[model samples]
Target: MHLPEIDRYGRGHSPLHRLDPRLKLPALGVFLLATNLTWKLPLAALFLLVAFLLTLLSRLPTNFVLWHLRAPAALGLILAFLLAIFTPGAPLVGPVTREGANLAATVFFKILASFLYFISMVATAPLFRTIQAARALGAPEKLLALFLFTYRYLFALLDRARNLSLAMQARGFREKTDRRTYELKARLYALLFLRAYEETERVLLAMYARGFSNPRVTLPQPLTSAQVLRGLPLLSLALLLLALNFFW
Candidate 1:
């Protein structure tokens, strides 16, 4: 990915960004656990409130956060309506009943809450750092390596395709052109696919030459006490939401 795009969405100078990636990830996992396990509307509301507050603290745009949240929210909404309709329950809004309705509402809201929180975490934390954090949290060496390579090369391949497209356009590849643009575009795409495959093979060979398959140990960045101290409040908020669920 371009550094600027990643920096805008994935990393920034904020309390959330400064926290060790490893800690933030696990804290996120725990947040999801509490949200889903409790599966209560009140608990979900509390989690969303805290998540909203964190977005402010992290200095990410609300619109950007909403963009990521929309997809999961849409799916959750569909599932919730289906469950509420089918599950035996007292009538809620419309024809839906309340008995099993509450359970469906709880599950749906929990999923939405968890998705939004995770998206916020991603927006404020660099993907690379998150992967490193996962490694520190004991992700398998092979998986971690695969993650890194995939991350790097995925964007690299996209960049190459974009460049190729530009070159084609510059060479008069357009709808108005007399030549068959569709045929040309297909051949261009096929060539790109071949090139991409060849490039991938070269990369794999280079990795093999470097003994990437062999077990190797590498140190992740050290976490500072100050970083943990900052993250502690976020974790506390997650727990506090769980606690509040009991009173509700």
Candidate 2:
């Protein structure tokens, strides 16, 4: 299968792209941990700034990064609305209380910071490399294998579904706000599931035929001194955040 444009950007010759995936992966973990633990807005803003710098260092398209953030931004807004309406506190403005607004704002910034951190981490390396790095960091092999398979097949499944939708459209299938549309969608979903099951069976058979009974194990490449040094800045930033969380 052809690589998606979003995935293709990871192959760029940038500092972040060049960092060892093992180093990057753990650094991302610490960064995320620090971000989640931070409650103060100033600290969260710092984390966001770090995420932005990392994005720039990765040399990914700015528009692509912004587009990628849209889902998280939408979800954050929804969460803020729910918190403002549901959280119990004395009213500050309209239905929203001061405490509720503060909590919602905190959650929104936290989610935004996390989304940016993830995009920076994932965009800096190919998917397979990220999986491998997770394995190297002692993630369960079975879990990693599941992640690998899902990532590998998600696009293919989407393509199959798209083709099916296009074929239906060509056959004059017009969706409407009615029972017929719902029934057609249900049938389409069932057919997609069946096709996916059959494809999975074929893949398993092919794997068995090739004597692939066990998952192959390979050690991740060791990080060099220079690579470790290069990663120290991220680590230091995470530590600084953690220190602030504890002391501030």
Candidate 3:
């Protein structure tokens, strides 16, 4: 994984880290809006340039973002190539049609913007803070509840899988084990799935017994107007650049 999972995401020390997740979350949303509002490639490039600088300012290593980009890069390359071949617009080069290539370029930029926005958000905000911010931003209660359950259950699922794997190893099963070992592995996987399901059910029943109705995750108080005010300058600068791109 690009990050060390939950730990790397919650550094919480730098200025960017210390800023309210509420601000960070909206900043990312505005950034996305700006990214899409302009079709000018150079303008989008500038947004990316600013994002690059922010990553550095946030004290995250370049690879921290780049590592996460691997999946996006692969997906983008595939989609770009397919769009270049199939979609029609302008000729890119001799024999290769222009229309297809131009649309492909647009797709690549769109994907890049999405990837950068998502990865940068993940790198800077702790998972819990991000969830809290999402809730604060008026995310639906149903969605919030689902996210809460998912966050807790993911680690639980992983722990169960690890235990199952260890039990198999203890039984003298290795990759080189015979065909019978294959059956044993399948059974182990079945048992793991069953265990995870039961555990989730148990958790739900326990929560219900405890009067859990709405999601109960705690977040530090919502960001004040003054706190949000601090990011205004940079946000304004970003919006200005985005606007200029269309006219210039």
- Which candidate number would show the highest TM-score if scored against the true structure? 2
Q: For model 3, which pairs clash?
A: 89-99, 89-100, 90-98, 90-99, 91-97, 91-98, 91-99, 92-98
The C-alpha local distance difference test score for the whole of candidate 3 amounts to: 0.71
Selected candidate, larger lDDT, 2 vs 3: 2
TM-score of every model versus the real structure: 0.74, 0.87, 0.75
Name the regions of candidate 3 deviating beyond 4 angstroms.
1-7, 87-95, 98-101, 163-192, 204-214, 241-248
* Worst ten in a row by lDDT for model 1: 1-10
Per-residue lDDT tens digits for candidate 3, residues 157-247, read 7777888888778877778568887898789889988997888789889989999877765657956787778767656765675567667
Highest lDDT: give the candidate number: 2
Ranking by TM-score: 2, 3, 1
Winner by TM-score between candidate 3 and candidate 1:
3
> Between prediction 1 and prediction 2, which has the larger TM-score?
2
C-alpha RMSD in Å of predicted model 3 compared with the true structure: 4.2
Model 1 misplaced regions, further than 4 Å: 1-7, 159-196, 206-218, 243-248
**What tens digits encode model 1's per-residue C-alpha lDDT throughout 1-248?**
23234335676777777777777788788777777667666767777777667767777777776766677888888888888888775677787878658867787767767876776676677676777778788889788877777766777788888888888879876665556777887887898899889998998899899887764436576888877787888888777766666676
Clashes of each: 6, 0, 8
